[model samples]
Target chain A: MPKKNLNKLREKIPLLEDIGKDGRVWSDLCKQYGVENPDPPWRITLESTCEVLNEGACALPVLERRDEEDKLSEEIYKDVPYPERQLLALAHSMIKKGFFREEELGVQMEKVYKRLSAGT
Target chain B: MSKSDKHDHNAAPMVDEISDFEVLEVAVRELCIEKGLFTQEDHNEWTEYMHTLGPLPAGRLVAKAWLDPEYKQLCIDDPVKASLEVGIDWINSMPSKFGTPSDYCNPRILVDTPTLKHVVVCTLCSCYPRPILGQSPEWYRTPNYRRRMVRWPRQVLSEFGLQLPEDVEIRVADSNQKTRYVVMPIRPDGTEGWTEDQLTEIVTRDCLIGVALPRADRKADDKRPIHKAVHPYGH
Candidate 1:
């Protein structure tokens, strides 16, 4: 993408700031994709964030993604698409802004992923 | 001594054995304390804080807005700041300065105009704005409610004894995301000269959730069937 176009797209998604920030990403997503929040916007955002990263790659920031072994999950990192990982990282940054606690993110993300997959 | 007395004594232990949740709750609390993750005082203080919360503060916020146009606009423009006027600091009031883990911080007040109405539902889970409005009702947390409210809002509202005109726009605010919501219903016709206290009394939890409208005479939520517990906690 052109630098200007990328900047414009970034500017449009103000929810990039935190989990609880304004729903700029939400309204923009709604307008661009006709995706109405069939549930609370945050739940959908959390679910989507997990979905986009599921068994693909760690999209979180370098420091944030560090495991006890100082290595990425070999199973998750296998064959992860570059663009997909980039998107996941972007979503992680947004969540880290306020919605996430460093210690609980893994557990919360797993629960959210399970709940979304359950389709309830 | 008697046959019936023997049966009653046997039933008591069965009821005592019913709580798997209590076992998990004890395990978590003990583990957290043992690990020094949080002190007993911290848990007790949060319990105290939970006791302090109810729908009153949120109701008062709506009442204050109804009585003042500028405050009402502030409510729409900056809900977190406006929440302070009603004595709720979303971030600071609780033990966590960052706000509740699940509820987050931002609150969206869906302003009801003459033609439009709003209702809330969490299709995934029972995600409510508990900071100001206290815990959600039992029915609000039901999977049945979560499934039906989004698809058939009018029917659900009707079940709650709230029927609107066909011309009225009923917007369902699905609380699937982080941003919590409360519906600021349009001020009713008869409450013109009522004091803030009176106005506050009428804005029950249901009204804020947009299942019911505020009225001059009504001061409490509609009673519903509450599933009784074997050993319910004493308040």
Candidate 2:
């Protein structure tokens, strides 16, 4: 697909927006994070392209956060390709565990970030 | 009578247009009865069950939820448990004590908040919540709908006349697994003091499917072209 249409397709799938551009971008990111290559990259391709057209409405901010916290999860995801279900399951679990208070997870994350930065 | 003008009084008109599907249906039904797989009474009872189903139960569920915050929370938290409030015992409602073999028991009610909207489509097949929402529409079962709705929900929803703001998070739930989903849209503004029954009237099938929004004035889905069947199931 053309770059413009590919971007359009990417908008629909929020999960893939953090992985940079194209399949090669993902492979390159994996290498940077010392992660194994996801052969075929079907999960990223299918989930990113086959999602509803949410554009960058929900993705842009989340991708920025992912980039900021890249080191935190580098070891966990170093050996496997990113799957959409895992993300969804994690979010649902977090919600259930009170990791998110109402709509603003920012408040909870801020407290964690402060505690971590203070080395306590 | 003259050779050209003579009518054949003893001859009968012959036109056989039965499709392969119809022929197979008859054969399989007769074979089942003969083999005692299920009696004719079972088939008739199932058909009767189908007749009793429609979108009313689902609509009532939504309506009841709108009226009561606790009930609404139950709908969002545990949809299967909430289903019982609306008279749908997924386990014992049908002949199978364990629930309908195909639809299963779990129901996921997608609650649309101010900033989020939800729609559902079975990417692999038409796996609908039949016990609550009744039969899946012909359009929902079409391969065209299944393929496009997941990819181009905005465009398809526009065809259905639902255009949401860009800020709204449009979540498309792909019902590929055992869980089935229904969209419980936030109660519209016009129904300020509406009763549950009145509110239920506006929660049409399309609204439940996330294709259309509920309005006090609108009680039915938009009209579409429907091809007549050779032998229609219901009048």
Candidate 3:
């Protein structure tokens, strides 16, 4: 085996399944091929820091999520993704007010708001 | 355009306003009351159960490990086994017969060394060693923190105000599976012959979480931006 592949294999380790696969999770599945039990450097990373807004007005995707498109000024978000059904109301309001930017995306509000009620 | 027009008195938006979680919370509470699974009084008891938790017990656990080599081995050999030494029974000590619903029994005590430092995370979910260490921080529960920490550990650590030496191996512990971990940071100087209580005082929640170094003078985690909860669970 080449040195580079060995290094790559080592770096591509999996975490979670703690107690290391009933106590030991070796780096590569191959490494565990021989060793009775190996303790890979137990690395667990928790997820946070999600993007609140993207290029589009995409927001309100979940019930538990903090929503209220009215909190921010109009035109800040356009064609926001209805993370929840409540956002559909907000999305309609944004469209009725002509708040969506159609010139850039070449999408008219009447057409897109049609999808909002369809419940995608 | 006006406040009165927004209410939609004819077709009130209240129906859609209620979240799934909110609906579930109501339905579950009602069912429990109806079926007598647990009374309203029992719910309050559980709420009080949460009140008795903090970093005190976990801090003491780390202190004892620092003081005794035998105890330290117990921490390394069997964390749940060693939990007994600190008066925390991994099994048969929670509301559940087996263990707490959220934080299960599998516990790992990561012993930090002079050349190595340890931190923990649960990228998929905020699966923490809650029975022992209490709840996780809001920041630790973020998707960005989870996704970036393991891949770019040094970068994340720096964000947490931890700049480690290149030689010092930074071992990241993901508490994603059954097992949950707490860092047993290396005992620092200035406390030559300190008692367990004194040592525990310094090992605040931050040290166990691997965000702050345990120090004799410091007995608490530094305050940061705390995004207030709408209906935060409080005593």
Candidate 4:
């Protein structure tokens, strides 16, 4: 059973635009989490020199942020769920949490940057 | 060489015409139609539904979660409930009111951390989250990928251009049973002041499929080998 507020928001959000790439909050998510590594470097090799492969989009940024986040977590992660479930989990979380308020999503990012700068 | 070639040509070789499997598939389809188990229209409708699906809705789901904490919690707790926000009534959205025959309603959301990156592949069949994410990709339905990815995820992720540190955990969610899974990667840093629309653009099909993650500039999945069909079905 869902909570009343979450149920209400579910009725309002449109399907297509929900995941649009907004720049503000995402940077904060990165800093708040304190992720240090960005993605594995993309180096072309003999096996992949001419292969026209289609790994879905969003591969690069996700890889990039993953490193930074690892620095914050302090826990060993040998069993992360697969992509499908992970996407599903976040979507589920949104329904209950009501997204980062535009301001919070934006304002919080600065905190992340400041935290990193203090140490570096 | 000439004597051996002559002998090889004379031999009554194994059957080489239409494959037995192909014949059986045709037989079953025709028989189903003949028996009225379902009209040809029903199968065609299902195909049309398949053609209409993609990673769009699933991407939106992720973006919305990033913007709203409440919604994200809903997603993490009960994916079936969270899906309603995207207008996908898993139980009643498709031709089958009870959800697809293969992908059931039990969808579990997996959250990603800096030390954890996730990707999904079915080893037995192409079991996917059809209601929100649409149809599974062609490569995902192949036996070679399924057989290899679960047991050798790091090796496979490397092939997909994802190479994590040894300390990072690589959990592979196998949809071998009833529950289907999707990844919910934490938002990345490139965009500092993006709108909902801006965020959704980065969550591509491949990201939802677990091969990649969402970013600010990217609007598409990685380009891969495309094997054209002799007679491709267009919806």
lDDT of each: 0.60, 0.58, 0.54, 0.53
Native contacts retained by candidate 4: 0.00
lDDT of 1 by residue, A28-70 (tens): 3345544454222233222223222221233332223322001
Local accuracy of candidate 4 as per-residue lDDT tens digits, A2-118: 356424433322221232222122223335545332211111110011011101122122222222112111111112212211222222233233332323323333454344335
Per-residue CA lDDT of model 3 for B1-235, tens digit only, reads 4333556666522222222222222332333344443455545544444545567788998999889999899888988888877778778665444653255788888889999999887766567787787656656654556667788898877766778999999999887678888999989899999999899999988889887788778887886442222222111
Q: State the lDDT at B118 in candidate 3.
A: 94
**Clash counts for the predictions, in order:** 12, 0, 20, 97
Better of 2 and 4 by lDDT: 2
| TM-score of each candidate structure, all chains considered together | 0.57, 0.56, 0.55, 0.54
Off by over 4 Å in 4: A1-120, B1-32, B44-48, B226-235
User: Which DockQ-derived CAPRI band holds candidate 1?
Assistant: incorrect
Q: Which ten residues in a row have the lowest lDDT in candidate 3 chain B?
A: B226-235
lDDT per residue for candidate 4 within B1-235, as digits (tens), equals 3222434655643222222222222332333344444456655556455545567777888889989999999999988888888776777766556653365788888888888888898765567887678656645754446667787788777777777899888888888777888888879898777887788889887888787777777787775542222222111
Assess candidate 2 and give its TM-score to the true structure: 0.56
Error of 2 at B17 (Å): 14
Candidate ordering by lDDT (highest first): 1, 2, 3, 4
Please tell me how candidate 3 rates in CAPRI terms. incorrect
Each candidate's fnat: 0.00, 0.00, 0.00, 0.00
The all-Cα superposition gives candidate 3 an RMSD in Å to the true structure of 19.6
Whole-model lDDT, candidate 4?
0.53
Candidate 2 lDDT over B1-235, as tens digits, reads 3332343655432211222222222332343344444456655556556556679989999999999999999998988789998988777776545653246788889999999999988866567888899867756754456768888899878878899999999999988777879899989998999999899999999899898889878987986432222232112
**How close to the true structure is residue A31 of candidate 4, measured as C-alpha lDDT?**
54
Which regions of candidate 3 fall more than 4 Å away from where they truly are? Answer: A1-120, B1-42, B226-235
